[model samples]
Target: MRGPWSSIQSKLVFLIAGISMVTVLVGFSLVTERFAQSLRDSLENDSLSLAQRLVVDSAAYLSLGMAGQARDNLLDKVVLNSPHSLALFDEQGGLFAEIERGGGQIVVDDYRPESAVIWESDWLHIYQPVEDSLDQRIGTLYLKISLSQLSHRMRAFVGVLLVLLLVMLALAYFLARLMQRYISGPILTLADISRQVRDHQNYSLRAPVKSSDEIGVLSQTFNDMLETIEQQQAFRDKVEQSLRIKEERLERAVAELQYMANYDSLTGLPNRALCMDRIELAIRHASRTRTYAGIIYLDLDHFKDVNDSLGHAVGDELLKATAERLSDVLREEDTLARIGGDEFVIITTDFSSSDQIIPLVSKVVERFEQNFTVGRYSVQSTVSLGVCVYPDDGDSVDALMKAADAAMYKAKDVGRNTYAFFEAEMNRMAVWRQQLGSELQHAIDRDELYLVFQPKVALESGQISGAEVLLRWEHPEFGSVSPADFIPVAEHTGLIYRIGLWVLEQACEAVSRWRDVGLEGVTVAVNLSAAQFRQADLVEHIAAILARHNVPPQTLELEITESMLVRDVDQAIRMLKRIKLLGLRVAIDDFGTGFSSLSYLRKFPLDALKIDRSFIMDLGKNRDDTAIALAIISMASSLRLKVVAEGVETPAQWSFLAGHLCDEVQGFLISPGLRESEFISFYKSFSLDEVIASRNV
Candidate 1:
């Protein structure tokens, strides 16, 4: 929308140039006028001196009674020297002799008898009275001169000023353009960003703030506004979602299965009771029939707002319409069920791939896009769907449903009104994770936690040096949830701190029991999460736990990953030194997988380095992994620290470690994590000679 002169840069330059021009012109005019005045004054002074001299000689000639001599004197001095015409007059004011230069006629105005100079247009006139030697007046000299030379000088001065005026204006404009960038650059950038935000609705873009000036303040304010908007939008979504989740949980908890009727009472579709049976049968049928089974988990998006704004009757009608629309869109082979409030599930027709189910889900999504008309009110609602294919997403009903449910929530997470397929990632199981987290919260209070110990054997003697204590859980419903699935959730939710303390106490108790049975040298290593490692009272807590359990300090090993110490090496060193002071063993777990520097490693209070399992998994097969493993072993040996190779499963891997003189190793080849009784038996019956003999074979 900017024109040629509309830009700030253009206007600023022009304004400066215009002011410069006017300033230069006015000052130039004043100077030239003063110079012209000086020139006229000089011309008058020179003319007066010449006329006085001529008159002096004329007066002497007239006194001698020789009028001809006086006239001759006038011709000799005046006519030869002056460019302007000169005339001599007697005491009676009559012309005696006349001289004219340039061959032009001379017209003289009435001249004053006293000494005077005057300018009439482009001419100058000077009058001076002539006097004799005795001071008696004989005649008056009248001189007239042209002002052409003075006029020429004045015109030349004006020409120089005009040139200077142009140069000053150009310089002023150049400076204005140069300085205006600092002012206008940020403003223009903001303007461009503002337009983009308006057109695209992308609030993530921010104007750069380069200074502490007003412009920078403006940019900061703009970015703050965008931040507030984004935060508010996210908060609003979370609020609505939380409200819906709470309401659903309450209603679903209260609702019961009706065994007599398999149909939902409200919509006449299959209810939860029939839905579970159908989903299981569909899985079995798909397996028997040799095709994939698809399950689409769907629910109304932001239906709580609808129910709240309108009455529950309107909300119920809307849900019924949604059910009808979905039933019409799906194939006859597909089983549609109303699982819960505003929630539905589909056991789809047999398919070869997830592609076959795509069309049905798309139709259902498209159908929901149209408004639903209730009796007196029209309601708009959209659906989010999660699609899962059998034997791919999962083989069982619970897993498939969990996958579909997770994908559905993911769809809702990404602005809803769309469909998503189940992705194979721990973080993607939105529905399963919610339940896992909720169950994990009560896991400790309900006494569902237990311990598993993986033993580390010293290679030379095959004696159990230590075992890394691991935590485990078996949820009554979810069955045997892996630590990998719940650990990150616990970390994010700050449950790790509590979980870590509990694990510490459990490991210590196990340590005390082992010591009681005369297994005092068998140290148990408990992995410390970052939260536990950073605890200000970590050393104190360990001391207290050891004292209370009556276990030797060296019997408990604290395994810390490299990442924990990378942030504050000095703080970690201090903490480690304090732990060492308490006679507790501290070993770096998974040594090479993080950002720990060799210099930093050298500075830490030493104990041991456990080579990461990744290297050991392919130790002899992969040269790069082999070199890294050997290098870590060599480095640990050089530092005089114990090197434990984890995940050493094969004879070739064990032979390589034994040949290289590795201190200790722990992996499935030795034993899987065992119960305390199993561990006690394994430790008592372990044979190093047999293991070495097997490796040789």
Candidate 2:
């Protein structure tokens, strides 16, 4: 139904037919022209041959003066051989003889050699001079060859050309029609499909692909585009329907995300992030109004015990109840937030005075006096509260939080269920503690730490038995940092593990050195911190250190505190047994200090019991201190454990401990902790009996 312009078939057929006709006409003309030129060349060659022969024959006749013979030869042999005319003329420009196919004579009035020959439109004329053997110009002969043979051949060529032209035209037309079907067919189909899709918005229609040509590729691409459009249209329809529901869900999702970000998931209270933001806002408000705001940081005491005894399910329920109870006690303007597990912060703004905030902190602490019922369990818990007021304790959120945290620890240090306000000195101490912790990590690498030995002597003879290894640090900035100062810092920061291992390695090496110098049976005792004792690799580490130094375990004694032994009695017993199995002596340092049960004392694998310095410092002056020291000595003797009294600075103290049957004594009364050289000198210079005899004298 498509028109010729629209139909590729019709248009290709017309284009092919017009091109074929023009090609045929041009080919016919070229063939006829070439054939006519060949026939003309043949006629010219034949006329030249006849003219040359006639000239030669006519020369003989002219030399002999026989014109009749020249005429017969030229006419019969030359002109008769060609469909042309022949003429002969003398040197004097007079016509001698002339012959033509029609037997007509050519009239020459004053023929010259230059005008001897002339070509006509239909004839090729040639002129030749007849010469004798003497090379003299005698006479001229001329011929006019006919071009009619060339015309006949051209006519015959045209007849054959027309026939071939018609045949070629038929083939070209058929070829064009076939090409249109194969090449343009797919393109037209694609166009039609596109039109249908554009008019009806139907993306499901696909164009037919019949060949692998460019048009076929175009059809395939159009089909792929339609498929993509169909998928996208279906997706678009689904998206439109879900968009409304997604909008509704989006609002609720935003609210939920915000709540989860700001509030604790378990207690539904503001989290640490929200609390800090509120604290900043509160500080700004207080700064603007020239008022005070208090930040009370509270942590529940013994909460871990509840979780450990019962399941975490009970712990969760308990935390929820605690949150509710704390919320009930807060004023409408006050805020309570859970920063972490069992730790809460309360911000009280709009307070006129510091005293007004005390009742709030007190109420929060008093609420824990009653037991909490969670599930089927009733748990008793207490809280330690640290309060820091704005413009007094700190001006910034981080500073205030740290100050309050320090104060809370101070409250726990004094007793649980108590509240303490942050003071300026507390901040200074916290900063100092942090600095000491930082410096302690590099103490060993800096070579600023060293060990001094304090000799333990037999009380009966006053002879040196062994030495205790004491850690000391000389800071480049602080001059001399006390063990009292940096030891706790190291312990708090978990640096004690590394420091303790270093001490053990050094002590073992020192003992090995002493033994190499003939100091037999010289044992070195190294104190182990609570943190060091809890390491899973403690036994292996100590064993490696001892083996590395080639020191026997008996010469390397490990001294642990009473508190370490009682922390977990069963685990402590296992560790002690392992230490004993290695042939290393174990001692309980600072006895009669930790609030441990006396019944478990016998279960510890110990070689000695060192009386705490606190008990020994007050000996002979305080009956309670005297009785405790005596009780330790008696218990150690009964248990067959060596008794050592520490910190015996005065004669009376040493004499009292010796008289009470204390087996070993270590303190300043003998000599302060000595450097390695000093200890070696002291060891060679004095014996137990000699020192005792000198003291008595």
Candidate 3:
């Protein structure tokens, strides 16, 4: 579909060359045609003139009557040195004389007159009349000339035109190729630069500026645009990096704030707020699923003692270590949180029964009981735990917490270092104790409690030498609750002060009653709790109790435990001296079981040491128990204090204690805890003669 002039350079060159060739061809053709016409006319003229000369000369020959030789001689003269052929004919149109000249070649027939002036194949022929002196139609002359030289000259002119055409074509091609390179090279370079920018993102590149033409200006403009793009890209990268760093710093700050809000900084455990939230969630889940969930609220039993004896730094370290151990033992589903100092709450879900929870509680207690080495000091601590199950104990968060707290106090009441599950009866007792605690404020005015005496007879003699005064609760609706139950309740609720005073007054009153009944010399022993012993007015309270009961201070014995003696020993010793000044005996109760310093034991004003029931139970079975008993008895004897073996259930145990010369024995084997009237009957039946007779063996 392309023409000969498709390319711009080719088209322009073809147009210029075609115009020049057409002008040269038209001029040469016109000149060549005119030259041919002129040559033909000149040849015709010369041929006629030569014909006339031949006729004149031939006439002389014909007049002399020798026509043949004269015609031959005349023809020879006319044809010689001339490039023509001649022929002579008679007027009759018959062949008369024919002369072939210029190589003796005849070009036409003599008889045909019309053929004399013929030009064919580049040869001219002529015919004319030849007349004698009389001027008659004597002969006709014909002449022929060769025109081959003229034809040869025309062919040479055509060859020169062809040669000029070839030269112009070669020049046109060279100019077209040069023009194509000049125009397309810069455009191709710009196209390559644009492609590089797009493919490689190399904005720094620019087109080459090779000339001051329009294309070169375009290249310079493109370079300027690329420089602008590079600057903008660099600015964007810096902004993005700065923004990223700022966002990262802000995120880190927010994370630190969140950690401080939800967790304890030192222990890394959930704080009070987080604990309450978890407990609330657990309660809601239990309500929705109708499953049992338990909350264990624990408090370290002797944390205060450790804090006082050791420093706060060691106490803090122990707490941190305890948190780690607790986290290790608890299940992933359970939540253990530290709600306050020395207090924690553990929430457990999906428990089927109390048995499932016992092992967990035991593990916690056992782990805590392990000695903690804090800053080169070894300290032993135990936890008292109170557990409350959902829906079984309470339905609401506050109610569950209150129930668990009351159960925890009950654990402390039984003794420290134990776990107790909340019971419905305990809930009622908790309410009752709350009410009684309020009522106890006026108990000194209202006589609500009293004391009863049970005689402690000597094992060897069966003689009644002492009596223990046990406090009894006389509830109006309950008729009479045992001292074993409410006495602890009283002690925990701080009602023991009023109750203890009342027991002291009644015991003094009983001493007066026994004297009136002729049993005056029996000493009355009263058990005292640590709470009562720590009272600032403990000595005054005891003095007033004895004075109001009309009982001699020497006849009243106040029994205290070794825990009370070791905890705040300086204060305990001072209080003991005050009690001794009131002329009352002080016996260390459950003596050998507690952690007491032996050097400090004899420093206190003590009347007796009561061996615990655990030692007495194993006295018949365990040699260790026997040796411990013997050691205690010897130590007490050396200190001039009486040794009493409690819980002697079998004859072997009684015989063992009697053989060891234990001062007194009390257990179910002698008599179950007797009523006042039953105790009196048993005491009368007990005869020293019978015991001595038995002992004599």
Best by TM-score: 2
lDDT (0 to 1) per candidate: 0.81, 0.82, 0.74
User: Quick one: best lDDT, which candidate?
Assistant: 2
Model 1 clash count equals 0
- 509-573 in candidate 3: lDDT tens per residue? 77766666667677878888776676678788777766776778888888888877775567678
Candidate 1 Cα RMSD (Å): 28.8
Off by over 4 Å in 1: 1-428, 691-697
TM-score ranking, high to low:
2, 3, 1
The TM-score that candidate 1 achieves is 0.41
Number of clashing residue pairs, candidate 2: 3
Q: Candidates' TM-scores?
A: 0.41, 0.59, 0.47
lDDT of 3 at 689: 57
Q: Which stretches of candidate 2 lie over 4 Å from their true place?
A: 1-276, 297-346, 363-385, 398-417, 427-431, 618-623, 637-640, 650-661, 689-697
Provide the lDDT at 137 for model 1: 66
Q: Taking the candidates one at a time, how many backbone clashes does each contain?
A: 0, 3, 2
Q: TM-score of predicted model 3? A: 0.47
How well is each residue in 654-682 modelled by candidate 2, as lDDT tens digits? 77987889998898777789988899999
Candidate 3 lDDT trough over 10 residues, lowest sum? 101-110
